[model samples]
Target: MPALKINVHFGGGAELLFDKIKKREVELPAVDKYLPECEKKGWTIRELLVWIKENLLRERPELFLQGESVRPGILVLINDTDWELYGELDYELQPSDTITFISTLHGG
Candidate 1:
């Protein structure tokens, strides 16, 4: 199987989520290997918002959500395009595809 590069960025306090995934507490794999991670994480494209809930808003109920209550500011991209635009996590990917996640903003 091809290796997938997962990137993550936290708008303000989202590094925690990234760290969790990096440490393997949040399991993910290459495109071909995605199903197992999704199943293990109890995730689906519709339920992808959990990544934000478990990592962000739950901690700060006072947080203001953007236009959509989503998985923080972390933008998940397959190669370059936003994963959300492609098909979210359900986006069909092949081996050798790269996945990146990044935050839109950060603290001063």
Candidate 2:
């Protein structure tokens, strides 16, 4: 199975949850390998979030995740376009695509 390579970015305080790392290039295994229960052939943002939580997130999972999606106030962009434009969590991921997460919430 071929791996899919994609870029991941965190910003607007979202990076804090990722150990202050602003960017990462991740190589995901075959969709069936990581998401055996999924009926789809391609990887979706929903599955990607699970992978992120397991592989990249170091702490405070609640701050970044809510169920299978991101918490409120977190803006998700795929390939520079809003994820909502691509069906949000159901959007299929493509190789070399860039996925970015920016938090709009801030402490006073």
Best by lDDT: 2
Model 1 lDDT per residue over 23-104, tens place = 2223334423544444433234333344445543335432324434444655666667777687775654443455454556
CA lDDT of each prediction against the hidden true structure: 0.46, 0.93
Top candidate (TM-score): 2
Q: Candidate 2, which ten residues in sequence have the lowest lDDT sum?
A: 33-42
Off by over 4 Å in 2: none
Every model: Cα RMSD to truth: 7.0, 0.9
